[model samples]
Target: MEKTLSVQGMSCGHCKMSVEGALKDLDGVSAAEVNLEAGSVDVTYDSEKVTVDAMIDAIEEQGYEVS
Candidate 1:
């Protein structure tokens, strides 16, 4: 499944990398693309292996707010 999450507090390359890395590190996540300007992330993952709540937690753990 794919999900687009609205994230806040991303302002630089490091922020983008962090969020992407966190998401991609998940077992089910195949891809994570962050649009810094849009403050959003597009994630592709297997719903059976991971849940959206987990993704949100990952992003939050990276210090970004995912809503």
Candidate 2:
């Protein structure tokens, strides 16, 4: 499934890359598109393998906030 998460504290390409890498490294995630200009992340993941909350945690782990 796909979901768009609102993110905060992203100021440049590095933040975008960091968040993208974290999500993409996960087992269930198929894709993670970080739109720095829009402050959002479009994620395609398998729910059976990962959870939305886990995705949020992954983003937070990268030092960003997901709302």
What are the TM-scores, per candidate, against the unseen true structure? 0.97, 0.96
* Model 2 agreement with the true structure over 1-67: per-residue lDDT tens digits: 9999999999899998999999999999999998888999999999999999999999999888888
- Error (Å) of candidate 2 at residue 64 is 0.8
Candidate 2: segments with Cα more than 4 A from true spot: none
Q: What digit string (tens of lDDT, one per residue) describes model 1 on residues 1-67?
A: 8899999999999999999999999999999999999999999999999999999999999998987
After aligning candidate 2 to the native by TM-score, how far in Å is the CA of 18 from where it should be?
Answer: 0.3
Per-candidate local distance difference test: 0.95, 0.95
Among these predictions, the greatest TM-score belongs to 1
Q: After superposition, how far is residue 50 of candidate 1 from its true place, in Å?
A: 0.4
